[model samples]
Target: MKRFSALGAMLALAGAAPLAGAAPQPPSCARPEWPQEARRYELEGVTTLNFRMGPDGRAIEPTVARSSRWAMLDQAAIASLSTCVFPAETVQRVQGKLLPLQFVWKLQGPDRVPPALVEGSCAASERFDRYVPFDKGVSGDDGVLVRLLVRGDGTPYGVKAEAGGADPALAQAAVEYVQSCRFAYPKAGASPGSPVSGRVLLKQ
Candidate 1:
Protein backbone atom coordinates (compact mmCIF):
# COMPACT_ATOMS: atom_id res chain seq x y z
CA MET A 1 0.00 0.00 0.00
CA LYS A 2 1.14 3.53 -0.74
CA ARG A 3 1.26 5.01 2.73
CA PHE A 4 2.03 8.54 1.55
CA SER A 5 -0.50 10.74 -0.22
CA ALA A 6 1.16 13.25 -2.50
CA LEU A 7 -0.53 16.64 -2.88
CA GLY A 8 1.53 17.20 -6.04
CA ALA A 9 4.93 16.35 -7.51
CA MET A 10 7.43 15.18 -4.97
CA LEU A 11 9.65 18.23 -5.39
CA ALA A 12 7.13 20.72 -6.72
CA LEU A 13 6.91 24.04 -4.85
CA ALA A 14 3.72 26.09 -4.82
CA GLY A 15 4.61 29.76 -4.49
CA ALA A 16 1.89 31.97 -3.09
CA ALA A 17 2.44 35.39 -1.60
CA PRO A 18 1.50 35.58 2.04
CA LEU A 19 -1.63 37.64 2.45
CA ALA A 20 -2.01 40.25 5.16
CA GLY A 21 -4.57 39.58 7.92
CA ALA A 22 -4.81 35.90 6.98
CA ALA A 23 -4.76 32.93 9.29
CA PRO A 24 -1.30 31.45 9.67
CA GLN A 25 -0.63 28.08 8.06
CA PRO A 26 2.26 26.14 6.66
CA PRO A 27 3.48 27.45 3.34
CA SER A 28 2.49 25.48 0.26
CA CYS A 29 5.49 23.34 -0.61
CA ALA A 30 6.58 19.81 -1.38
CA ARG A 31 5.26 17.38 1.20
CA PRO A 32 7.66 15.14 3.06
CA GLU A 33 7.50 11.44 2.38
CA TRP A 34 7.01 9.36 5.52
CA PRO A 35 10.21 7.67 6.62
CA GLN A 36 10.22 4.10 5.29
CA GLU A 37 11.43 2.68 8.58
CA ALA A 38 8.82 4.61 10.50
CA ARG A 39 6.08 3.47 8.16
CA ARG A 40 7.23 -0.15 8.37
CA TYR A 41 7.05 0.01 12.16
CA GLU A 42 3.76 1.89 12.09
CA LEU A 43 5.16 4.98 13.81
CA GLU A 44 2.97 8.06 13.52
CA GLY A 45 2.98 11.50 15.15
CA VAL A 46 2.78 15.24 14.56
CA THR A 47 6.05 17.17 14.32
CA THR A 48 6.02 20.95 14.53
CA LEU A 49 9.04 23.06 13.56
CA ASN A 50 10.11 26.68 13.18
CA PHE A 51 12.92 28.30 11.25
CA ARG A 52 14.16 31.71 10.25
CA MET A 53 14.24 32.68 6.59
CA GLY A 54 17.70 33.09 5.18
CA PRO A 55 18.73 36.06 3.02
CA ASP A 56 17.99 33.84 -0.01
CA GLY A 57 14.49 33.18 1.31
CA ARG A 58 15.50 29.65 2.31
CA ALA A 59 15.04 28.12 5.73
CA ILE A 60 17.93 28.65 8.10
CA GLU A 61 18.75 26.89 11.35
CA PRO A 62 15.48 25.00 11.44
CA THR A 63 14.56 23.71 14.90
CA VAL A 64 11.95 21.39 16.24
CA ALA A 65 9.52 23.34 18.38
CA ARG A 66 7.46 20.25 19.33
CA SER A 67 8.56 16.70 18.85
CA SER A 68 6.24 14.04 17.50
CA ARG A 69 7.81 11.80 20.18
CA TRP A 70 9.70 10.17 17.30
CA ALA A 71 13.03 11.33 16.01
CA MET A 72 12.58 10.02 12.46
CA LEU A 73 9.36 11.95 11.95
CA ASP A 74 10.87 15.11 13.35
CA GLN A 75 13.90 14.84 11.08
CA ALA A 76 11.76 14.10 8.06
CA ALA A 77 9.63 17.17 8.74
CA ILE A 78 12.68 19.36 9.08
CA ALA A 79 14.27 18.03 5.89
CA SER A 80 11.20 18.71 3.77
CA LEU A 81 10.39 22.13 5.16
CA SER A 82 13.95 23.30 4.73
CA THR A 83 13.38 23.38 0.98
CA CYS A 84 10.56 25.91 1.30
CA VAL A 85 11.33 29.37 -0.05
CA PHE A 86 9.53 32.61 0.59
CA PRO A 87 9.50 36.08 -0.92
CA ALA A 88 12.22 38.32 0.48
CA GLU A 89 9.64 40.95 1.39
CA THR A 90 7.49 38.41 3.20
CA VAL A 91 10.48 37.11 5.11
CA GLN A 92 11.42 40.66 6.10
CA ARG A 93 7.90 41.24 7.34
CA VAL A 94 8.05 38.14 9.55
CA GLN A 95 11.62 38.64 10.63
CA GLY A 96 10.78 38.93 14.30
CA LYS A 97 9.38 35.37 14.52
CA LEU A 98 10.44 32.08 13.04
CA LEU A 99 8.09 30.66 10.45
CA PRO A 100 5.94 27.88 11.86
CA LEU A 101 5.60 24.55 10.05
CA GLN A 102 3.91 21.32 11.03
CA PHE A 103 3.74 17.80 9.58
CA VAL A 104 0.93 15.40 10.51
CA TRP A 105 1.66 11.70 9.94
CA LYS A 106 -1.31 9.37 9.93
CA LEU A 107 -1.63 5.92 8.46
CA GLN A 108 -4.30 5.71 5.75
CA GLY A 109 -7.46 3.59 6.10
CA PRO A 110 -9.03 1.63 8.96
CA ASP A 111 -8.22 -1.88 10.20
CA ARG A 112 -4.52 -1.16 10.21
CA VAL A 113 -2.38 -4.07 11.31
CA PRO A 114 0.15 -3.51 14.08
CA PRO A 115 3.78 -4.13 13.23
CA ALA A 116 4.97 -7.53 14.36
CA LEU A 117 8.47 -8.72 15.17
CA VAL A 118 9.70 -11.70 13.20
CA GLU A 119 12.11 -14.21 14.68
CA GLY A 120 15.65 -14.00 13.34
CA SER A 121 14.64 -10.94 11.38
CA CYS A 122 17.38 -8.30 11.29
CA ALA A 123 14.71 -5.66 10.98
CA ALA A 124 13.72 -6.47 14.55
CA SER A 125 17.05 -4.97 15.55
CA GLU A 126 16.58 -1.67 13.76
CA ARG A 127 17.38 1.13 16.14
CA PHE A 128 16.78 4.87 16.06
CA ASP A 129 18.95 5.71 19.09
CA ARG A 130 21.84 6.53 16.76
CA TYR A 131 21.16 9.93 15.27
CA VAL A 132 21.91 10.71 11.63
CA PRO A 133 23.36 14.18 11.22
CA PHE A 134 20.99 16.45 9.31
CA ASP A 135 22.56 18.35 6.43
CA LYS A 136 20.20 20.98 5.08
CA GLY A 137 22.11 20.88 1.79
CA VAL A 138 21.54 17.17 1.27
CA SER A 139 18.55 15.62 -0.43
CA GLY A 140 16.19 13.55 1.73
CA ASP A 141 16.20 10.69 -0.80
CA ASP A 142 19.90 10.08 -0.37
CA GLY A 143 20.05 6.54 1.04
CA VAL A 144 21.07 2.98 0.23
CA LEU A 145 19.03 -0.19 0.53
CA VAL A 146 20.90 -3.12 2.06
CA ARG A 147 20.28 -6.89 2.04
CA LEU A 148 21.47 -9.17 4.81
CA LEU A 149 22.05 -12.84 5.57
CA VAL A 150 21.65 -13.62 9.25
CA ARG A 151 23.20 -16.35 11.40
CA GLY A 152 21.30 -18.34 14.00
CA ASP A 153 23.08 -16.47 16.80
CA GLY A 154 21.64 -13.01 15.99
CA THR A 155 24.57 -11.87 13.89
CA PRO A 156 24.73 -11.04 10.23
CA TYR A 157 26.99 -13.32 8.23
CA GLY A 158 26.50 -11.62 4.88
CA VAL A 159 25.65 -8.02 4.17
CA LYS A 160 25.59 -6.38 0.77
CA ALA A 161 23.95 -3.45 -0.97
CA GLU A 162 21.47 -4.18 -3.69
CA ALA A 163 22.72 -3.20 -7.12
CA GLY A 164 21.12 0.08 -8.14
CA GLY A 165 21.66 3.81 -8.56
CA ALA A 166 22.97 4.50 -5.02
CA ASP A 167 26.50 5.85 -4.85
CA PRO A 168 29.20 3.22 -4.40
CA ALA A 169 30.60 4.87 -1.29
CA LEU A 170 27.15 5.21 0.18
CA ALA A 171 26.46 1.56 -0.58
CA GLN A 172 29.66 0.51 1.14
CA ALA A 173 28.80 2.62 4.13
CA ALA A 174 25.38 1.00 4.32
CA VAL A 175 26.83 -2.52 4.08
CA GLU A 176 29.24 -1.74 6.91
CA TYR A 177 26.44 -0.23 8.97
CA VAL A 178 24.36 -3.40 8.69
CA GLN A 179 27.33 -5.67 9.24
CA SER A 180 27.99 -3.88 12.54
CA CYS A 181 24.46 -4.39 13.82
CA ARG A 182 23.53 -7.44 15.95
CA PHE A 183 20.21 -8.75 14.76
CA ALA A 184 17.39 -10.42 16.70
CA TYR A 185 17.56 -14.19 17.00
CA PRO A 186 15.01 -16.81 17.76
CA LYS A 187 14.43 -17.98 21.36
CA ALA A 188 17.00 -20.39 22.78
CA GLY A 189 14.81 -23.44 22.17
CA ALA A 190 13.64 -22.38 18.72
CA SER A 191 15.36 -23.49 15.55
CA PRO A 192 17.12 -20.52 13.87
CA GLY A 193 18.66 -21.46 10.55
CA SER A 194 17.44 -19.43 7.62
CA PRO A 195 18.42 -16.55 5.38
CA VAL A 196 16.67 -13.35 6.38
CA SER A 197 16.88 -10.08 4.51
CA GLY A 198 16.58 -6.52 5.85
CA ARG A 199 17.23 -2.94 4.77
CA VAL A 200 18.09 0.37 6.45
CA LEU A 201 17.44 3.97 5.49
CA LEU A 202 20.48 6.26 5.48
CA LYS A 203 18.64 9.55 5.01
CA GLN A 204 21.27 12.18 5.79
Candidate 2:
Protein backbone atom coordinates (compact mmCIF):
# COMPACT_ATOMS: atom_id res chain seq x y z
CA MET A 1 0.00 0.00 0.00
CA LYS A 2 3.03 2.30 -0.25
CA ARG A 3 3.65 4.63 -3.13
CA PHE A 4 7.20 5.96 -3.47
CA SER A 5 7.90 8.97 -5.70
CA ALA A 6 10.84 11.00 -7.06
CA LEU A 7 11.85 14.61 -6.33
CA GLY A 8 14.01 17.28 -7.95
CA ALA A 9 17.34 18.84 -6.88
CA MET A 10 18.46 22.25 -8.15
CA LEU A 11 22.04 23.28 -8.79
CA ALA A 12 23.10 26.71 -7.55
CA LEU A 13 26.21 28.58 -8.53
CA ALA A 14 28.96 29.10 -5.98
CA GLY A 15 28.57 32.65 -4.74
CA ALA A 16 30.30 33.50 -1.45
CA ALA A 17 32.47 31.18 0.56
CA PRO A 18 30.63 28.24 2.08
CA LEU A 19 29.39 28.67 5.65
CA ALA A 20 31.43 27.48 8.56
CA GLY A 21 30.72 23.89 9.60
CA ALA A 22 31.27 24.61 13.27
CA ALA A 23 28.17 23.73 15.26
CA PRO A 24 25.70 26.60 15.78
CA GLN A 25 26.42 28.70 18.83
CA PRO A 26 24.22 30.93 20.98
CA PRO A 27 22.41 34.12 19.75
CA SER A 28 21.78 32.55 16.33
CA CYS A 29 18.07 31.98 16.72
CA ALA A 30 16.48 33.49 13.61
CA ARG A 31 13.75 31.21 12.30
CA PRO A 32 12.55 31.21 8.71
CA GLU A 33 8.97 31.50 7.51
CA TRP A 34 6.92 29.41 5.13
CA PRO A 35 6.09 31.05 1.84
CA GLN A 36 2.47 32.24 1.59
CA GLU A 37 2.01 30.54 -1.74
CA ALA A 38 3.64 27.40 -0.41
CA ARG A 39 1.41 27.37 2.65
CA ARG A 40 -1.74 27.82 0.57
CA TYR A 41 -0.80 24.80 -1.50
CA GLU A 42 0.82 22.92 1.42
CA LEU A 43 4.39 22.67 0.24
CA GLU A 44 7.24 22.00 2.70
CA GLY A 45 11.00 21.51 2.57
CA VAL A 46 14.34 22.50 4.16
CA THR A 47 16.37 25.40 2.79
CA THR A 48 19.96 25.10 3.94
CA LEU A 49 21.44 28.59 3.72
CA ASN A 50 24.66 30.51 4.27
CA PHE A 51 25.35 34.18 4.94
CA ARG A 52 28.56 36.10 5.43
CA MET A 53 29.21 38.12 8.59
CA GLY A 54 30.52 41.35 7.10
CA PRO A 55 33.34 43.14 8.91
CA ASP A 56 30.73 45.43 10.48
CA GLY A 57 29.19 42.48 12.37
CA ARG A 58 26.04 42.55 10.26
CA ALA A 59 24.81 39.76 8.00
CA ILE A 60 25.47 40.27 4.32
CA GLU A 61 24.75 38.39 1.12
CA PRO A 62 22.61 35.57 2.44
CA THR A 63 22.44 32.91 -0.26
CA VAL A 64 21.09 29.44 -0.82
CA ALA A 65 24.04 27.19 -0.07
CA ARG A 66 21.78 24.22 -0.68
CA SER A 67 18.49 24.27 -2.50
CA SER A 68 15.29 22.67 -1.22
CA ARG A 69 14.30 22.40 -4.88
CA TRP A 70 11.66 25.06 -4.25
CA ALA A 71 12.73 28.52 -5.30
CA MET A 72 10.15 30.20 -3.08
CA LEU A 73 11.29 28.38 0.03
CA ASP A 74 14.91 29.22 -0.65
CA GLN A 75 14.13 32.90 -1.14
CA ALA A 76 12.11 33.01 2.07
CA ALA A 77 15.05 31.66 4.04
CA ILE A 78 17.48 34.18 2.56
CA ALA A 79 15.28 37.13 3.56
CA SER A 80 15.02 36.04 7.22
CA LEU A 81 17.56 38.55 8.51
CA SER A 82 16.84 42.28 8.73
CA THR A 83 19.07 43.14 11.67
CA CYS A 84 21.95 40.73 12.09
CA VAL A 85 24.14 41.85 14.98
CA PHE A 86 27.53 40.25 14.80
CA PRO A 87 30.05 40.74 17.60
CA ALA A 88 33.31 42.04 16.17
CA GLU A 89 35.24 40.09 18.80
CA THR A 90 33.52 36.86 17.82
CA VAL A 91 34.03 37.62 14.14
CA GLN A 92 37.71 38.17 14.82
CA ARG A 93 38.03 34.76 16.43
CA VAL A 94 36.27 33.23 13.45
CA GLN A 95 37.77 35.60 10.87
CA GLY A 96 36.19 34.09 7.77
CA LYS A 97 33.10 32.55 9.25
CA LEU A 98 29.77 32.22 7.44
CA LEU A 99 26.48 31.30 9.09
CA PRO A 100 24.55 28.23 8.02
CA LEU A 101 21.01 27.21 8.84
CA GLN A 102 18.38 24.71 7.71
CA PHE A 103 14.98 26.36 7.45
CA VAL A 104 12.21 23.76 7.62
CA TRP A 105 8.57 23.80 6.43
CA LYS A 106 6.28 21.53 8.43
CA LEU A 107 2.49 21.84 8.39
CA GLN A 108 0.03 21.29 11.22
CA GLY A 109 -3.30 19.89 10.12
CA PRO A 110 -5.41 16.72 9.75
CA ASP A 111 -5.83 16.90 6.00
CA ARG A 112 -4.23 14.23 3.82
CA VAL A 113 -4.93 15.91 0.52
CA PRO A 114 -1.66 15.59 -1.35
CA PRO A 115 -0.11 18.89 -2.54
CA ALA A 116 0.16 19.44 -6.26
CA LEU A 117 1.97 21.88 -8.50
CA VAL A 118 -0.81 22.29 -11.00
CA GLU A 119 -4.52 21.78 -10.27
CA GLY A 120 -4.42 18.33 -8.64
CA SER A 121 -2.28 15.92 -6.73
CA CYS A 122 1.15 15.52 -8.21
CA ALA A 123 1.91 12.83 -10.77
CA ALA A 124 5.08 10.83 -10.18
CA SER A 125 7.17 8.60 -12.38
CA GLU A 126 6.70 4.83 -12.27
CA ARG A 127 10.17 4.50 -10.82
CA PHE A 128 9.42 3.88 -7.16
CA ASP A 129 9.31 0.11 -7.65
CA ARG A 130 12.99 0.01 -8.50
CA TYR A 131 14.17 2.67 -6.05
CA VAL A 132 14.64 0.83 -2.76
CA PRO A 133 16.45 -2.49 -2.57
CA PHE A 134 15.86 -3.81 0.93
CA ASP A 135 15.20 -7.20 2.37
CA LYS A 136 11.67 -7.67 3.68
CA GLY A 137 13.07 -9.25 6.80
CA VAL A 138 15.01 -6.17 8.02
CA SER A 139 13.02 -3.39 6.40
CA GLY A 140 11.30 -2.98 9.81
CA ASP A 141 7.87 -1.81 8.69
CA ASP A 142 5.48 -2.55 5.86
CA GLY A 143 4.47 1.11 5.66
CA VAL A 144 5.51 4.59 6.77
CA LEU A 145 4.36 8.15 6.15
CA VAL A 146 6.89 10.27 4.24
CA ARG A 147 6.54 14.04 4.40
CA LEU A 148 7.74 15.80 1.28
CA LEU A 149 8.12 19.37 0.01
CA VAL A 150 6.84 19.44 -3.54
CA ARG A 151 7.89 22.31 -5.77
CA GLY A 152 5.42 24.12 -8.03
CA ASP A 153 6.69 22.32 -11.07
CA GLY A 154 6.04 18.93 -9.42
CA THR A 155 9.59 18.20 -8.28
CA PRO A 156 9.74 16.91 -4.73
CA TYR A 157 12.10 19.43 -3.18
CA GLY A 158 12.45 17.66 0.12
CA VAL A 159 11.61 14.39 1.95
CA LYS A 160 11.33 13.67 5.66
CA ALA A 161 10.84 10.64 7.93
CA GLU A 162 7.53 10.63 9.73
CA ALA A 163 5.92 8.63 12.54
CA GLY A 164 7.60 7.64 15.80
CA GLY A 165 10.24 5.82 13.83
CA ALA A 166 10.99 2.98 11.40
CA ASP A 167 13.76 0.54 10.63
CA PRO A 168 16.98 2.48 10.20
CA ALA A 169 17.88 0.86 6.92
CA LEU A 170 14.35 1.14 5.59
CA ALA A 171 14.06 4.80 6.49
CA GLN A 172 17.36 5.65 4.86
CA ALA A 173 16.38 3.74 1.77
CA ALA A 174 13.04 5.43 1.59
CA VAL A 175 14.59 8.91 1.81
CA GLU A 176 17.24 8.15 -0.77
CA TYR A 177 14.67 6.66 -3.11
CA VAL A 178 12.43 9.67 -2.85
CA GLN A 179 15.29 12.15 -3.26
CA SER A 180 16.20 10.56 -6.57
CA CYS A 181 12.65 10.79 -7.90
CA ARG A 182 11.03 13.09 -10.50
CA PHE A 183 7.36 14.10 -10.56
CA ALA A 184 4.81 16.45 -12.21
CA TYR A 185 1.60 18.12 -11.11
CA PRO A 186 -0.40 18.29 -14.34
CA LYS A 187 -3.06 20.77 -13.20
CA ALA A 188 -2.00 22.02 -9.78
CA GLY A 189 0.46 24.42 -11.43
CA ALA A 190 3.92 25.26 -10.09
CA SER A 191 3.75 26.08 -6.36
CA PRO A 192 5.45 24.73 -3.26
CA GLY A 193 3.79 21.88 -1.27
CA SER A 194 5.33 21.61 2.20
CA PRO A 195 4.22 18.28 3.54
CA VAL A 196 3.06 15.97 0.84
CA SER A 197 2.73 13.48 3.67
CA GLY A 198 2.15 10.35 1.63
CA ARG A 199 1.94 6.84 3.04
CA VAL A 200 4.48 4.45 1.60
CA LEU A 201 3.88 0.72 1.97
CA LEU A 202 6.68 -1.58 1.02
CA LYS A 203 6.30 -4.05 -1.84
CA GLN A 204 6.40 -7.74 -1.13
The best candidate by TM-score is 1
| TM-score on alpha carbons, each prediction | 0.45, 0.42
Judged by lDDT against the true structure, how good is candidate 2? 0.51
**Which digits, one per residue and each the tens of the lDDT, describe model 2 over residues 1-204?**
112111222222134233332213333434455556566435556667776666766667777776655567677766765344545465655546666656665555443434432322222434234332121121235654455666665567567644334676666566766665555544433334534545445665
Error of 1 at 161 (Å): 24
Candidate 2's C-alpha runs over 4 A off are 1-25, 28-31, 109-204
- Which residue pairs does candidate 1 place in steric collision? none
Looking at model 1, report the run of 10 residues with the lowest lDDT sum: 128-137
lDDT of each: 0.53, 0.51
RMSD of each: 11.4, 13.4
Give the clash count for each candidate.
0, 21
